[model samples]
Target chain A: GGIITQTPKFLIGQEGQKLTLKCQQNFNHDTMYWYRQDSGKGLRLIYYSITENDLQKGDLSEGYDASREKKSSFSLTVTSAQKNEMAVFLCASSIRLGGHAETLYFGSGTRLTVL
Target chain B: GDSVTQKEGLVTLTEGLPVMLNCTYQTIYSNAFLFWYVHYLNESPRLLLKSSTDNKRTEHQGFHATLHKSSSSFHLQKSSAQLSDSALYYCALSHTGYQNFYFGKGTSLTVIP
Candidate 1:
Protein backbone atom coordinates (compact mmCIF):
# COMPACT_ATOMS: atom_id res chain seq x y z
CA GLY A 1 0.00 0.00 0.00
CA GLY A 2 1.10 3.57 -0.70
CA ILE A 3 0.15 6.96 0.69
CA ILE A 4 -0.61 10.39 -0.80
CA THR A 5 1.11 13.33 0.88
CA GLN A 6 0.19 16.99 0.55
CA THR A 7 2.42 19.76 1.75
CA PRO A 8 1.61 22.85 3.89
CA LYS A 9 -1.53 21.48 5.45
CA PHE A 10 -2.50 25.07 6.19
CA LEU A 11 -2.10 28.09 3.91
CA ILE A 12 -2.69 31.80 4.46
CA GLY A 13 -2.80 34.23 1.57
CA GLN A 14 -3.87 37.75 0.61
CA GLU A 15 -6.17 38.83 -2.14
CA GLY A 16 -4.66 38.66 -5.64
CA GLN A 17 -1.75 36.65 -4.31
CA LYS A 18 -0.65 33.62 -6.23
CA LEU A 19 -0.25 30.46 -4.23
CA THR A 20 0.61 26.90 -5.00
CA LEU A 21 -0.29 23.59 -3.39
CA LYS A 22 1.76 20.42 -3.80
CA CYS A 23 0.88 16.77 -3.67
CA GLN A 24 2.91 13.57 -3.85
CA GLN A 25 1.80 9.98 -4.09
CA ASN A 26 3.95 6.89 -3.69
CA PHE A 27 1.23 4.67 -5.08
CA ASN A 28 2.52 5.10 -8.64
CA HIS A 29 -0.99 5.54 -9.88
CA ASP A 30 -1.33 6.87 -13.40
CA THR A 31 -3.94 9.48 -12.63
CA MET A 32 -3.78 12.50 -10.27
CA TYR A 33 -6.48 15.04 -9.45
CA TRP A 34 -7.02 18.31 -7.59
CA TYR A 35 -10.30 19.22 -5.95
CA ARG A 36 -11.61 22.04 -3.81
CA GLN A 37 -14.00 21.54 -0.92
CA ASP A 38 -15.93 24.45 0.46
CA SER A 39 -17.62 24.42 3.84
CA GLY A 40 -20.87 22.45 3.69
CA LYS A 41 -20.33 21.94 -0.05
CA GLY A 42 -19.28 18.96 -2.06
CA LEU A 43 -15.83 18.66 -3.52
CA ARG A 44 -15.35 20.07 -7.04
CA LEU A 45 -12.69 18.82 -9.31
CA ILE A 46 -10.24 21.50 -10.44
CA TYR A 47 -7.82 19.63 -12.63
CA TYR A 48 -6.60 16.16 -13.42
CA SER A 49 -3.60 14.60 -15.08
CA ILE A 50 -3.88 11.19 -16.63
CA THR A 51 -0.16 10.83 -17.09
CA GLU A 52 3.01 12.72 -16.20
CA ASN A 53 2.61 15.35 -18.90
CA ASP A 54 -1.10 15.24 -19.50
CA LEU A 55 -3.43 17.98 -18.27
CA GLN A 56 -7.20 18.09 -18.22
CA LYS A 57 -9.61 20.72 -16.94
CA GLY A 58 -12.64 20.20 -14.74
CA ASP A 59 -15.64 22.39 -14.02
CA LEU A 60 -13.74 24.49 -11.49
CA SER A 61 -10.50 24.74 -13.38
CA GLU A 62 -10.69 28.47 -13.89
CA GLY A 63 -8.32 30.61 -11.80
CA TYR A 64 -6.27 27.47 -11.23
CA ASP A 65 -3.45 25.89 -13.21
CA ALA A 66 -2.04 22.42 -12.69
CA SER A 67 1.14 20.64 -13.68
CA ARG A 68 2.17 17.04 -13.35
CA GLU A 69 5.89 17.55 -13.17
CA LYS A 70 6.59 13.92 -12.48
CA LYS A 71 4.77 10.66 -12.14
CA SER A 72 4.53 11.07 -8.35
CA SER A 73 4.03 14.81 -8.02
CA PHE A 74 1.20 17.11 -9.09
CA SER A 75 1.00 20.80 -8.32
CA LEU A 76 -1.89 23.27 -8.37
CA THR A 77 -1.40 27.03 -8.64
CA VAL A 78 -4.03 29.54 -7.70
CA THR A 79 -3.44 32.33 -10.19
CA SER A 80 -4.99 34.90 -7.91
CA ALA A 81 -6.45 34.34 -4.50
CA GLN A 82 -9.74 36.01 -3.72
CA LYS A 83 -10.67 37.50 -0.39
CA ASN A 84 -12.94 35.24 1.67
CA GLU A 85 -11.77 32.38 -0.47
CA MET A 86 -11.40 29.90 2.29
CA ALA A 87 -11.53 26.23 1.37
CA VAL A 88 -9.70 22.95 1.57
CA PHE A 89 -7.84 21.70 -1.47
CA LEU A 90 -7.71 17.96 -1.78
CA CYS A 91 -5.45 15.74 -3.88
CA ALA A 92 -6.40 12.33 -5.17
CA SER A 93 -5.00 9.51 -7.28
CA SER A 94 -6.59 6.67 -9.15
CA ILE A 95 -5.35 3.76 -11.17
CA ARG A 96 -7.57 4.13 -14.25
CA LEU A 97 -10.91 5.38 -15.58
CA GLY A 98 -14.10 3.42 -14.71
CA GLY A 99 -15.03 0.54 -12.37
CA HIS A 100 -12.66 -1.49 -10.20
CA ALA A 101 -9.66 0.06 -11.87
CA GLU A 102 -11.21 3.53 -11.43
CA THR A 103 -11.34 3.98 -7.68
CA LEU A 104 -9.84 7.22 -6.40
CA TYR A 105 -7.89 7.67 -3.16
CA PHE A 106 -7.60 11.11 -1.62
CA GLY A 107 -4.86 12.77 0.40
CA SER A 108 -5.17 14.83 3.55
CA GLY A 109 -6.51 18.21 2.38
CA THR A 110 -4.74 21.56 2.49
CA ARG A 111 -6.84 24.21 4.17
CA LEU A 112 -6.43 27.66 2.63
CA THR A 113 -7.56 30.95 4.05
CA VAL A 114 -7.35 34.16 2.08
CA LEU A 115 -7.31 37.44 3.91
CA GLY B 1 -23.43 16.97 -16.97
CA ASP B 2 -23.55 14.49 -14.11
CA SER B 3 -24.68 15.66 -10.68
CA VAL B 4 -25.15 14.21 -7.19
CA THR B 5 -27.41 15.26 -4.35
CA GLN B 6 -27.29 14.25 -0.70
CA LYS B 7 -30.41 15.67 0.92
CA GLU B 8 -29.54 15.69 4.63
CA GLY B 9 -26.65 17.88 5.61
CA LEU B 10 -26.45 16.38 9.08
CA VAL B 11 -27.62 13.10 10.61
CA THR B 12 -27.48 12.35 14.32
CA LEU B 13 -27.83 8.79 15.51
CA THR B 14 -27.37 6.80 18.70
CA GLU B 15 -24.69 4.20 18.91
CA GLY B 16 -25.72 0.63 18.02
CA LEU B 17 -28.73 1.99 16.18
CA PRO B 18 -29.45 1.72 12.50
CA VAL B 19 -28.43 4.57 10.22
CA MET B 20 -29.08 5.67 6.69
CA LEU B 21 -27.73 8.42 4.42
CA ASN B 22 -29.53 9.33 1.28
CA CYS B 23 -27.80 9.88 -2.05
CA THR B 24 -29.33 10.58 -5.44
CA TYR B 25 -27.77 11.26 -8.80
CA GLN B 26 -28.58 12.49 -12.32
CA THR B 27 -26.70 11.80 -15.49
CA ILE B 28 -27.21 11.97 -19.21
CA TYR B 29 -25.23 8.87 -20.00
CA SER B 30 -26.64 5.37 -19.69
CA ASN B 31 -23.40 3.87 -18.43
CA ALA B 32 -22.64 5.69 -15.19
CA PHE B 33 -20.98 4.86 -11.89
CA LEU B 34 -21.81 5.86 -8.32
CA PHE B 35 -19.48 6.07 -5.36
CA TRP B 36 -19.54 6.69 -1.63
CA TYR B 37 -16.56 8.36 -0.01
CA VAL B 38 -16.05 8.86 3.72
CA HIS B 39 -14.09 11.73 5.20
CA TYR B 40 -13.10 11.84 8.85
CA LEU B 41 -11.81 14.88 10.65
CA ASN B 42 -8.06 15.22 10.37
CA GLU B 43 -8.03 12.45 7.79
CA SER B 44 -8.35 12.17 4.07
CA PRO B 45 -11.39 10.99 2.18
CA ARG B 46 -11.54 7.25 1.48
CA LEU B 47 -13.74 5.10 -0.67
CA LEU B 48 -16.52 3.48 1.36
CA LEU B 49 -18.28 1.81 -1.56
CA LYS B 50 -18.79 1.94 -5.32
CA SER B 51 -21.13 0.31 -7.78
CA SER B 52 -22.30 0.50 -11.36
CA THR B 53 -24.53 -2.53 -11.34
CA ASP B 54 -28.13 -1.50 -11.48
CA ASN B 55 -30.31 -2.59 -8.56
CA LYS B 56 -27.43 -4.43 -6.94
CA ARG B 57 -26.24 -4.11 -3.35
CA THR B 58 -22.63 -3.23 -2.75
CA GLU B 59 -21.16 -3.85 0.72
CA HIS B 60 -17.90 -2.95 2.37
CA GLN B 61 -16.67 -2.91 5.94
CA GLY B 62 -20.18 -3.28 7.31
CA PHE B 63 -21.54 -0.49 5.17
CA HIS B 64 -23.78 -1.17 2.21
CA ALA B 65 -25.19 0.79 -0.69
CA THR B 66 -27.49 -0.24 -3.49
CA LEU B 67 -27.76 1.44 -6.83
CA HIS B 68 -31.31 1.90 -8.02
CA LYS B 69 -30.95 2.89 -11.62
CA SER B 70 -34.66 3.26 -12.00
CA SER B 71 -34.72 5.71 -9.11
CA SER B 72 -31.35 7.28 -9.84
CA SER B 73 -30.31 6.79 -6.22
CA PHE B 74 -27.50 5.09 -4.34
CA HIS B 75 -28.36 5.55 -0.68
CA LEU B 76 -25.93 4.24 1.93
CA GLN B 77 -26.90 2.33 5.04
CA LYS B 78 -25.52 0.29 7.88
CA SER B 79 -27.27 -2.14 10.24
CA SER B 80 -25.52 -0.79 13.32
CA ALA B 81 -24.07 2.64 13.81
CA GLN B 82 -20.90 2.96 15.82
CA LEU B 83 -19.33 6.01 17.43
CA SER B 84 -16.41 5.51 15.12
CA ASP B 85 -18.75 5.86 12.18
CA SER B 86 -19.08 9.60 12.71
CA ALA B 87 -17.73 11.36 9.66
CA LEU B 88 -18.57 13.26 6.51
CA TYR B 89 -19.92 11.24 3.60
CA TYR B 90 -19.92 12.26 -0.04
CA CYS B 91 -21.84 10.77 -2.92
CA ALA B 92 -20.20 10.97 -6.30
CA LEU B 93 -21.08 10.13 -9.89
CA SER B 94 -19.30 9.88 -13.19
CA HIS B 95 -20.10 8.85 -16.70
CA THR B 96 -18.40 6.11 -18.66
CA GLY B 97 -16.27 8.52 -20.70
CA TYR B 98 -16.21 11.55 -18.42
CA GLN B 99 -12.85 12.55 -17.08
CA ASN B 100 -14.10 14.49 -14.08
CA PHE B 101 -16.36 13.22 -11.30
CA TYR B 102 -19.20 15.12 -9.67
CA PHE B 103 -19.80 15.01 -5.91
CA GLY B 104 -22.81 15.85 -3.80
CA LYS B 105 -22.98 18.22 -0.87
CA GLY B 106 -21.49 16.27 2.02
CA THR B 107 -23.57 14.74 4.80
CA SER B 108 -22.13 14.88 8.27
CA LEU B 109 -23.09 11.91 10.43
CA THR B 110 -22.57 12.05 14.15
CA VAL B 111 -23.11 9.02 16.37
CA ILE B 112 -23.62 9.57 20.08
CA PRO B 113 -23.10 7.15 22.89
Candidate 2:
Protein backbone atom coordinates (compact mmCIF):
# COMPACT_ATOMS: atom_id res chain seq x y z
CA GLY A 1 0.00 0.00 0.00
CA GLY A 2 1.16 3.51 -0.76
CA ILE A 3 0.83 6.55 1.46
CA ILE A 4 0.48 10.28 0.90
CA THR A 5 2.56 12.38 3.26
CA GLN A 6 1.89 16.00 4.18
CA THR A 7 4.55 17.99 5.97
CA PRO A 8 4.12 20.19 9.04
CA LYS A 9 0.73 18.87 10.17
CA PHE A 10 0.15 22.17 11.98
CA LEU A 11 0.90 25.64 10.68
CA ILE A 12 0.58 29.08 12.24
CA GLY A 13 0.98 32.16 10.11
CA GLN A 14 0.41 35.86 10.58
CA GLU A 15 -2.27 37.59 8.58
CA GLY A 16 -1.05 38.68 5.16
CA GLN A 17 1.92 36.33 5.39
CA LYS A 18 2.75 33.83 2.70
CA LEU A 19 2.59 30.11 3.58
CA THR A 20 3.41 26.98 1.69
CA LEU A 21 2.30 23.38 2.16
CA LYS A 22 3.90 20.33 0.62
CA CYS A 23 2.66 16.88 -0.31
CA GLN A 24 4.24 13.68 -1.53
CA GLN A 25 2.63 10.48 -2.68
CA ASN A 26 4.25 7.12 -3.18
CA PHE A 27 1.35 5.61 -5.08
CA ASN A 28 2.80 6.83 -8.34
CA HIS A 29 -0.63 8.13 -9.33
CA ASP A 30 -0.86 10.38 -12.34
CA THR A 31 -3.22 12.93 -10.87
CA MET A 32 -2.68 15.07 -7.75
CA TYR A 33 -5.07 17.50 -6.09
CA TRP A 34 -5.23 20.17 -3.40
CA TYR A 35 -8.38 20.69 -1.35
CA ARG A 36 -9.38 23.10 1.39
CA GLN A 37 -11.53 21.90 4.30
CA ASP A 38 -13.46 24.35 6.41
CA SER A 39 -15.61 23.77 9.49
CA GLY A 40 -19.17 22.81 8.55
CA LYS A 41 -18.07 22.83 4.90
CA GLY A 42 -16.82 19.92 2.87
CA LEU A 43 -13.63 19.71 0.94
CA ARG A 44 -13.28 22.16 -1.96
CA LEU A 45 -10.82 21.66 -4.76
CA ILE A 46 -8.15 24.32 -4.98
CA TYR A 47 -6.00 22.92 -7.79
CA TYR A 48 -5.14 19.66 -9.50
CA SER A 49 -2.35 18.36 -11.67
CA ILE A 50 -2.98 15.61 -14.17
CA THR A 51 0.68 15.10 -14.88
CA GLU A 52 4.07 16.27 -13.79
CA ASN A 53 3.84 19.58 -15.65
CA ASP A 54 0.11 20.07 -15.97
CA LEU A 55 -2.06 22.24 -13.75
CA GLN A 56 -5.83 22.84 -13.64
CA LYS A 57 -7.70 25.39 -11.57
CA GLY A 58 -10.80 24.45 -9.61
CA ASP A 59 -13.62 26.60 -8.25
CA LEU A 60 -11.56 27.77 -5.24
CA SER A 61 -8.25 28.39 -6.96
CA GLU A 62 -8.04 32.08 -6.23
CA GLY A 63 -5.39 33.21 -3.70
CA TYR A 64 -3.59 29.90 -4.07
CA ASP A 65 -0.97 28.49 -6.38
CA ALA A 66 0.05 24.89 -6.99
CA SER A 67 2.98 23.17 -8.67
CA ARG A 68 3.72 19.59 -9.60
CA GLU A 69 7.49 19.66 -9.75
CA LYS A 70 7.70 15.89 -9.90
CA LYS A 71 5.37 12.98 -10.40
CA SER A 72 5.46 12.17 -6.69
CA SER A 73 5.40 15.68 -5.26
CA PHE A 74 2.91 18.57 -5.35
CA SER A 75 3.11 21.86 -3.53
CA LEU A 76 0.61 24.60 -2.72
CA THR A 77 1.29 28.20 -1.71
CA VAL A 78 -1.00 30.72 -0.07
CA THR A 79 -0.36 34.12 -1.63
CA SER A 80 -1.58 36.07 1.37
CA ALA A 81 -3.06 34.46 4.42
CA GLN A 82 -6.20 35.99 5.88
CA LYS A 83 -7.83 35.66 9.27
CA ASN A 84 -10.68 33.63 7.88
CA GLU A 85 -8.33 31.35 5.97
CA MET A 86 -7.65 29.16 8.97
CA ALA A 87 -8.55 25.64 7.92
CA VAL A 88 -7.14 22.30 6.92
CA PHE A 89 -5.61 21.71 3.50
CA LEU A 90 -5.71 18.19 2.14
CA CYS A 91 -3.70 16.56 -0.63
CA ALA A 92 -4.91 13.67 -2.70
CA SER A 93 -3.75 11.47 -5.55
CA SER A 94 -5.62 9.23 -7.95
CA ILE A 95 -4.98 6.86 -10.81
CA ARG A 96 -7.30 6.83 -13.80
CA LEU A 97 -8.01 3.38 -15.15
CA GLY A 98 -9.21 2.86 -18.71
CA GLY A 99 -9.94 6.58 -19.00
CA HIS A 100 -12.38 6.41 -16.14
CA ALA A 101 -12.49 8.20 -12.83
CA GLU A 102 -10.99 6.22 -9.96
CA THR A 103 -10.99 6.50 -6.18
CA LEU A 104 -8.93 9.21 -4.54
CA TYR A 105 -6.32 8.64 -1.79
CA PHE A 106 -5.86 11.59 0.53
CA GLY A 107 -3.23 12.73 3.00
CA SER A 108 -3.94 13.40 6.66
CA GLY A 109 -4.00 17.18 5.90
CA THR A 110 -2.22 20.31 7.09
CA ARG A 111 -4.00 22.48 9.61
CA LEU A 112 -3.42 26.18 9.08
CA THR A 113 -4.07 28.89 11.63
CA VAL A 114 -3.85 32.52 10.59
CA LEU A 115 -3.69 35.16 13.30
CA GLY B 1 -21.19 22.15 -13.43
CA ASP B 2 -21.82 19.54 -10.78
CA SER B 3 -22.66 19.94 -7.08
CA VAL B 4 -23.63 17.73 -4.14
CA THR B 5 -25.84 18.57 -1.16
CA GLN B 6 -26.01 16.84 2.19
CA LYS B 7 -29.08 18.09 4.03
CA GLU B 8 -28.20 17.07 7.60
CA GLY B 9 -25.04 18.64 8.92
CA LEU B 10 -25.07 16.56 12.09
CA VAL B 11 -26.75 13.31 13.06
CA THR B 12 -26.88 11.90 16.58
CA LEU B 13 -27.96 8.35 17.19
CA THR B 14 -27.70 5.59 19.77
CA GLU B 15 -25.66 2.51 19.15
CA GLY B 16 -27.54 -0.38 17.53
CA LEU B 17 -29.97 2.03 15.89
CA PRO B 18 -30.36 2.50 12.18
CA VAL B 19 -28.15 5.00 10.34
CA MET B 20 -29.16 7.17 7.44
CA LEU B 21 -27.51 10.17 5.82
CA ASN B 22 -29.16 12.08 3.03
CA CYS B 23 -27.25 13.11 -0.09
CA THR B 24 -28.48 14.87 -3.20
CA TYR B 25 -26.78 16.17 -6.27
CA GLN B 26 -27.22 18.30 -9.40
CA THR B 27 -25.32 17.76 -12.58
CA ILE B 28 -25.76 18.18 -16.34
CA TYR B 29 -23.87 15.06 -17.33
CA SER B 30 -25.79 11.83 -17.87
CA ASN B 31 -23.00 9.46 -16.91
CA ALA B 32 -22.50 10.87 -13.46
CA PHE B 33 -20.84 8.86 -10.70
CA LEU B 34 -21.77 9.19 -7.03
CA PHE B 35 -19.41 8.52 -4.15
CA TRP B 36 -19.52 8.36 -0.34
CA TYR B 37 -16.40 9.12 1.64
CA VAL B 38 -15.73 8.75 5.34
CA HIS B 39 -13.38 10.77 7.49
CA TYR B 40 -12.45 9.43 10.90
CA LEU B 41 -11.00 11.56 13.66
CA ASN B 42 -7.39 12.47 12.85
CA GLU B 43 -7.51 10.29 9.79
CA SER B 44 -7.54 11.19 6.14
CA PRO B 45 -10.78 11.02 4.24
CA ARG B 46 -11.19 7.86 2.14
CA LEU B 47 -13.65 6.35 -0.25
CA LEU B 48 -16.36 4.36 1.50
CA LEU B 49 -18.62 3.58 -1.43
CA LYS B 50 -19.27 4.60 -5.04
CA SER B 51 -21.70 3.82 -7.84
CA SER B 52 -22.12 4.82 -11.46
CA THR B 53 -25.10 2.70 -12.41
CA ASP B 54 -28.48 4.17 -11.61
CA ASN B 55 -30.78 2.26 -9.30
CA LYS B 56 -28.04 -0.18 -8.40
CA ARG B 57 -27.13 -0.53 -4.76
CA THR B 58 -23.54 -0.42 -3.57
CA GLU B 59 -22.23 -1.57 -0.24
CA HIS B 60 -18.96 -1.41 1.67
CA GLN B 61 -17.87 -2.02 5.23
CA GLY B 62 -21.46 -2.38 6.49
CA PHE B 63 -22.54 0.74 4.66
CA HIS B 64 -24.76 0.94 1.57
CA ALA B 65 -25.78 3.57 -0.94
CA THR B 66 -27.81 3.48 -4.13
CA LEU B 67 -27.74 6.07 -6.83
CA HIS B 68 -31.19 7.22 -7.89
CA LYS B 69 -30.81 9.30 -10.98
CA SER B 70 -34.50 10.07 -11.14
CA SER B 71 -34.37 11.75 -7.76
CA SER B 72 -30.79 12.92 -8.02
CA SER B 73 -29.99 11.35 -4.67
CA PHE B 74 -27.57 8.78 -3.26
CA HIS B 75 -28.26 8.37 0.42
CA LEU B 76 -26.02 6.28 2.66
CA GLN B 77 -27.58 3.79 5.00
CA LYS B 78 -26.62 1.22 7.58
CA SER B 79 -29.00 -1.14 9.35
CA SER B 80 -27.24 -0.86 12.70
CA ALA B 81 -25.22 2.05 13.83
CA GLN B 82 -22.07 1.33 15.82
CA LEU B 83 -19.77 3.50 17.87
CA SER B 84 -17.03 2.85 15.37
CA ASP B 85 -19.23 4.30 12.66
CA SER B 86 -19.09 7.75 14.16
CA ALA B 87 -17.32 9.98 11.68
CA LEU B 88 -17.76 12.62 9.01
CA TYR B 89 -19.49 11.52 5.82
CA TYR B 90 -19.21 13.30 2.52
CA CYS B 91 -21.02 12.80 -0.75
CA ALA B 92 -19.23 13.44 -4.01
CA LEU B 93 -19.96 13.49 -7.75
CA SER B 94 -18.00 13.16 -10.97
CA HIS B 95 -18.86 12.50 -14.58
CA THR B 96 -17.34 10.11 -17.07
CA GLY B 97 -14.38 11.41 -19.09
CA TYR B 98 -13.74 14.15 -16.55
CA GLN B 99 -11.17 14.36 -13.80
CA ASN B 100 -12.90 16.95 -11.68
CA PHE B 101 -14.88 15.83 -8.62
CA TYR B 102 -17.41 17.82 -6.57
CA PHE B 103 -18.14 17.26 -2.90
CA GLY B 104 -20.95 18.18 -0.55
CA LYS B 105 -20.69 19.97 2.79
CA GLY B 106 -20.61 16.60 4.66
CA THR B 107 -22.59 15.14 7.56
CA SER B 108 -21.05 14.48 10.96
CA LEU B 109 -22.46 11.38 12.62
CA THR B 110 -22.04 10.67 16.31
CA VAL B 111 -23.17 7.31 17.62
CA ILE B 112 -23.44 7.33 21.38
CA PRO B 113 -23.17 4.21 23.41
- Model 2 preserves the real interface contacts to a fraction of 0.76
Write candidate 1's Cα lDDT for A12-80 as tens digits.
999999999999999999989999998687898899998899999988999999999899999999999
What does candidate 2's lDDT look like per residue over A1-115, in tens digits? 9999998799999999989999999999999999999879889999999999899998899999999999999999999999866799999999987675589999999999998
Give the CAPRI class of candidate 2: medium
lDDT by candidate, in order shown: 0.91, 0.93
Report, for all candidates in order, the number of backbone clashes.
0, 0
Query: What lDDT is reached at residue A12 by model 2?
Result: 96
Q: Output candidate 2 Cα RMSD.
A: 1.1
- Candidate 1, residue B51: Cα displacement in angstroms equals 1.0
Docking model 1 quality class: medium
In model 2, which runs have C-alpha deviations exceeding 4 angstroms?
none
lDDT value for candidate 2? 0.93
Candidate 1 backbone collisions, by pair? none
Interface quality of candidate 1 as DockQ: 0.58
